[model samples]
Target: MSQLATRPPLILTLRMDSQSQEFFNAFRKTYFPPERNYLDAHLTLFHHLNDNDQTLATVKSIAQPAFTLKTTGMKFLGAGVAFAIESKELHNIRKELAIQLHEQLIPQDKQGYRPHITIQNKVSPEAAKQLLNELQSTFQPITITARGLDLWQYLGGPWKHHAYHALGPAPG
Candidate 1:
């Protein structure tokens, strides 16, 4: 198999809503300049699909009509910013889906499993501390409903807004 065929695919996700999109865009703008805003707005559900056909088939097999996921609070990962999922159902569902993928399709990595959405990167230790302080003072809990799933490709290039492709509804 070719190298690209050997590598796994990525599942990009988000709480498909105007507020979520706007928030992501604003957050990116604040942290990353236009030139650096290569990564499109998304919350990743899982990564490293072993086989695209098998992965897609599995997803399709478990497909649901539709479902909503909500984000409830703000979290700080050093200098990285993220919102937490409030709904137990949403959290459980995402975890279950990831576990299923890991067990059935992809092998686990050394990193183990931890779910998060990265809002920004590139912070000095001092800057991270400052940002954390600011987050404590200024961050407010926000909620958003997720509605879609995307199958994305990392084209061996700088992160760009066009790297994602909609893969239809998420399997609820």
Candidate 2:
């Protein structure tokens, strides 16, 4: 059995600017199905990682230099929808961690990363489509800098936030 099967699987997220975070979160609260919405708007780096010393060590070791993130507009998620993200630097960070994790990563984390912030999910297909169109019609390119990385423990329904790994060169 995989380590994820034994312990709480860890999730990695890119910390967004406070303003943007507030906006997206409010957008989610307004649109997302209230009964199913459990977490705030976030950009997930790794969906599932095994919790261990190495995982925490590598996370804390990273000095995430702030990087520009662009929104490529909306994407249809069949029964849901999300704002697509574009960031080569973010992908590189994920790649670097993937290399370090090797076989320790969960199968889901092993796949290619398609970074996005889901604002609505598990709603009727028509509802999702309507929102996607509405958002896309009004969509303006948003450029924001990611401040750091966040590690979380997935608790069946709600998540337990662990720590935020600030980016940039560590002070000597």
Per model, state how many residue pairs clash: 3, 3
Tens digits of per-residue lDDT for model 1, 34-144: 565677556766554554565555545444334555555556667566555555544455565665666644454324444455656556656656655676687666656
Poorest 10 consecutive residues by lDDT, candidate 2: 163-172
RMSD each, Å: 4.3, 2.9
Residue 95's C-alpha lDDT in candidate 1? 64
lDDT at 132, model 1: 58
Among the numbered candidates, top lDDT falls to 2
Name model 2 segments beyond 4 Å from true: 1-6, 169-172
Give TM-scores for every candidate, taking all chains together and pairing residue i with residue i.
0.70, 0.91
Give the whole-model CA lDDT for all candidates, comma-separated.
0.55, 0.86
